[model samples]
Target: MPQHHDPGTADAPEGQASKSGFRPTAVAAVELGVVGQSVGVTVPGASESVQVTGISLDSRTVERGDLYVALPGAARHGADFARTALEAGAVAVLTDDAGARLLALGSDIAVPVLVVAEPRSVVGRLSRLIYRSQDADLPGPSMFGVTGTNGKTTTTYFINALLQAMGKKTGLIGTIEILAGGDPIPSLLTTPESTDVHALLALMRERGLDAASMEVSSHAVSFRRVDGVVFDVVGFTNLTQDHLDLHGTMEEYYRTKAELFTAERARAAVVTVDDEWGRRLAAQTELPVTTLATIQPGSGPEADPAGPAGADWTVTDSKPRGLGTEFTLRGRNGTELRVHTGLPGAFNVSNAALALAMVLAGGADPAEVQAALDSKDPFTVAVPGRMQLVSTRPAAVVDFAHNTDALARALAAVRSPEPASKVIVVFGATGQRDQGKRPSMGATAARLADVVIVSDDDPHDEDAAAIRAEVLVGATDAKEAEQLDCKIMEVYPRDAAIREAVNLAAPEDTILIAGRGHEVWQEVKGVNLALDDRVELRNALTARGFTVLQDDGIES
Candidate 1:
């Protein structure tokens, strides 16, 4: 049977607390009436003394003294779960009229019911009011938010690394993990829900972390996940085709990302003017904007000089440094800072450049930024799945390049310059996403890679075979139309595809496992299958006598 999961909501962990078990413990309970009135919603039958110390959107994550917000979901109303929220110690419920009626039908739900005209719209304001997330009196961490189709995760990781290099304690929120000066908490979405986001920010402040960096995805912006949080600096990586399933068009997607740069959300901006979208966003944003340009091999030709030519900061004198690259950040004001990243791929150079530029935008002294770069080499830090290296022999690597442009760039970045060395790429498009990109991804692999292997990537209730066939169509068409010399094959159950790539590879060849990086699970027909690409690549490489790198205490 096909398991139907809610597309609108993330598959959040089912518990009262996240893995970190960190929530605002010192919160002063706010009255239910006061909370409702703060968001312009009315609490009719609720007592004025009914107090809530926390806010939660998912019933399963409800804690004691929580205002469980029952927003309307696509497949089912959250009101349907109000009884469970009550059972999980939710003291009150905030929902729309439909939810109020549903609660009325469920007589056992006797808690306060605060009705709102639009429950989702008011959730952020209500959460802020209850949590004091952005109260001017409290000292909060300086927040940085990054958005785009491809580089959001890597850029945010770079931002956190640079901040740490500058001697500031840091927290990170992104697709891979969440950090709050403690152990890493695995993340489900690029950004968490507004309620959890506020709680995490408060937790960072309580822990005395000086700064935090977050990946602001298009879905996060569209779904109100980042509602109450404002950033000290916001960055725009180049926007490309993605999330069309949600935004319906490239224009809408660009608009959704641009929303994060408003004065309300961020104080300053760092725009990477490598593409027209970044140029448009830099011009259109009301916040004070700082433009950056990186002319890198992975980014292809410069965008006609309309974007990067007249930028505030430009990456100049870039040269290859082993597997990585070394570049100079030349400011228009004659300030030059040397930058180097051990991470491979020209795109990583761009990501590194953006990170350095953003730290300066966030009020870090330029000399301090330079000192950090010189001392720590922060941009060279290993970002878990963004171009993570697994083996020296065969040069096995994994990355999160699901979109066409990203795939093209990743393939270009990993292709060896050695004339005899081949690029074997194992990749597949995600199911239930923007289906239009699958063929483009296929053609991209066929063009750049010596061997194109189409495999499964999170089929998620969609037919895996059908998804593979779509990708195969593009690869096959490209091979024939362009008479490309790439060998194309279809493989199933991703692990086998990975093993096949290893079996086909030579010691000098490069194996790129794209589309799933750092992600440990593959969802198929609604069940999460434990599948880590790095682990698989490592095990396969070691079995074939390839020397693998040590990771997470696992000796090579």
Candidate 2:
């Protein structure tokens, strides 16, 4: 419990910290002055001094001399784990008033217990301090952020690839995994918890990573998951109606995303003004904005001149080639960047362009960034689940197009003109998410694809049938609106749905399995079962006597 050490003191063993790239930063747990000044959260108790080396939200990961942050959990109070965490070498405790009261029933609690009004809110600032991201000498990774309803994952991936292609050692933190200098480390949240984020940044710095491409989810921004982190460059993909349950309204959602582009969050920005939301966001941001558009750049129904998106860049002459595409990127600076990408679709072209602009904003020479694209392996990155092609012959593609907008794009991308006969799409609605998108998604599939097989996606306590019914309503509505009878089938499990979609496909026909792209598990009734669309689609295709094409490692 001694606090008479340097704030930068490390209690970690000689080489123990180096393995995970952890640098222990200790602070006297008795000091809550920073928290008081930051968010007006006070520690009412007369605290005894303890050397806190780390911070943790979960008791399971608590290290020796750690400050266990006891936040209010959904099931129970996190203070319940305070004793457990302390038992596992936690030196002090930080929590809410209720959590403090709960800890008070025990006389054995000797460590400093600081009760703040909003424990979760201040945890980020505290974590930033404890992890040394705020330290001047650390010079942490150059963070690049991508935010939107769709294309966040793909854009971040593209940004990471671009950074790597430019010869910088990079890390990636997004929906899929945290790649430390291109090494894959599994992740749970799109944007990790504040402590995890700061810690990862610290790790990336210590491990010699020069840059990182991170997905900035609106939830993370609203929840203060990214409170203390700053980005060198940020990109905005178009926003849509999603996460309504968390944000409550599209306006609130937009504002939350807008938080990232503020001078406090990012230094420079690149935004795709294909939608009005991005245009509006670009106008409001204090950072310098480089607007991009896949559609009409400066005029017509798509352009919003009233907002900030008076396009500075546009994707022109974009020609899709199977799983890849070639496009001419034109910027207001009069630089015509010719881009060839393994990533398919106009949306991907927009993503690559935004990535190029972001890297340029992040201090990469535009000519060099453009030159990286033409290198034999330039921009040949295949993002998992974002338009991931898993098969050939009766071609099957897996995409993480869970929402209506994303689904429409995925369908359009795979709906080939000549080679493919029928575009058979198998998709499902996630339970307990934006229910409004169910019908819209179904309708989009109905309008775009030749056949639709609706199935389950993370049923998570809701009846899969009910969610499917809502999506089916959209399919029905599409049929009614167009006065055309479209083929629709309801499948309970996703594997059956994949098989059905594959079975219904001909050699020339395309099979698109939307939702659950690179996700390796299916959430059902509280348990997550191993299930991946790419794997399942491949299995289904192999069972149908089709020799699935060899998976080229570097290419899709």
Candidate 3:
């Protein structure tokens, strides 16, 4: 959904089903008669009949006894793959009139065809029908969803960790990976396609999980990947400039995000009022809404004492603890809890707070969520790449900050330790995505960090140097306009960029390598090479005379 990266980058292959073989129970065409009636499609050839065991959007993954969905796509028609799906033993084909017209032109398509009006919109419901029957039917876990420009992954991870702390088997879906009450599985998309989402839910049900948390991206919302999901409690962590390429405008982006707060999408919602977008969303949502704010004097100068936000839950106290921070959340009903997070910075505090509220809203035990938030316990929720420290002497950290807002926040969080600690940041924009953010990121980095290293992020096909030049324009503007003392340097390969940052920093300074979080592969011209930032940072630090340890709990 986030414009697929390569085929096998981080996600499992399409045909590589779960060990349990993700196919749900078989359903007859008569069973899905309701789906057809809703869309005015009739299944021909009365096999009454054929039972479909699986539903696949990708023709490549369709197995015998499976029904393949054929729909129009952005680049090409899914009907083009109908022959492949038929060859893969698919029982029948489901498509709209457009795809049916394409099938009519082909002479070899002899399988049953069921037409639908909008395949994308009904596919989620169809997936649920193929997998789950009802919310109360199986041992399925209650779901929680989080959406925003940033913090979706961290917040979902936080919710998953808390659910586990409460002694519930948890399933997690995020940008980095997916955990279906089993081991961590590489995530193909931030929010997977609807068919995968329903399949994963069924898989979690089979594994005896009690709860699951999913990160819902705006793209997933606009593209109907999450059309039929019913989240127990959805969360909104501040939205900023992002994904304008997909939504076309900021208003459209906000509307797409707002779609999740409706009763159809979620049972209830928790919103952070740290930004105007969050405030507007909270005010507009019709479902049961709970507001969480880790900061006072919210995004605007206004605060409503009797409204859903600022009136429901507010942070009344805060203090920086050793290696972490502590804060207090108060409910409008006079409920209060003292919380501590092993993570640093106020943004993480907001994340933890929002996570706590959403889980609580989803019927988790309050005592357990609060206990999990206690700083004295073993740290259970650590995001893989957000402000992760690789070297202590120079305080070199790696973050997934590709946008202006995220980059500025990462620099601010790193600099929060001490005023005397200077900052050196290394990052570059991805090729052909939100090109407008490039110069904005440059200006933000120059304004916040003492040194900016402009380098490659993932130059898909565009000339890498040309993209760098556009970013340099903003860096030059920031340097000249503010008369800042920051020095700008251009570097090739991101690995060399890390080395440059290490070379520029001293024992007292901070070095931040931004963009590309837990991603292990780097996209260049269609090829995804191994280029993890953590590995590169540790290698650069070790090469620059710093101790580096292997991931296996041992020093290399």
How close to the true structure is residue 466 of candidate 2, measured as C-alpha lDDT?
A: 94
lDDT of 1 at 145: 89
- Candidate 1 lDDT by residue in tens digits, 133-192: 778999889998888887888888888888888889999998888899889877887888
Assess the local accuracy of residue 493 in candidate 3 as a C-alpha lDDT between 0 and 100.
86
Tens digit of per-residue lDDT, candidate 3, span 235-307: 9987778888788788989999999999988899999877768888988999999887766763322333433
- In order, candidate lDDTs are 0.85, 0.77, 0.77
Between candidates 1 and 3, the one scoring higher on TM-score is 1
TM-score of each model, paired residue for residue: 0.95, 0.90, 0.91
What tens digits encode model 2's per-residue C-alpha lDDT throughout 1-556?
Answer: 3212111112222222212223333333424444444546454455433455677777767788678888876557888767777888987787888888989876579776777788887888888877776467768688899999888888888888887777889988888878876457666678777877888877787778889999999888977889888888989988888899788899999988888998888888998887878877877889988888777445433455553334788777877665778888787778888887887676777787888778877888878877777774456687888887777677678888888888888888787676538989999999999888899999988998888899999898888889999999989888888976569888868999888988888888889988888877787886777787777778788888877767622121
lDDT of 2 at 494: 92
Question: What is the TM-score (0 to 1) of candidate 3?
Answer: 0.91
| Ten contiguous residues with the weakest lDDT in model 2 | 2-11
Q: Which regions in candidate 1 have their CA more than 4 angstroms from the true location? A: 1-8, 12-22, 44-46, 296-299, 305-307, 552-556
- The residue ranges of model 2 lying beyond 4 angstroms of the native Cα positions read 1-49, 297-310, 552-556
Q: Could you give the C-alpha RMSD of every candidate to the true structure, in order shown?
A: 2.7, 5.9, 3.9
The residue pairs that clash in candidate 1, if any, are none
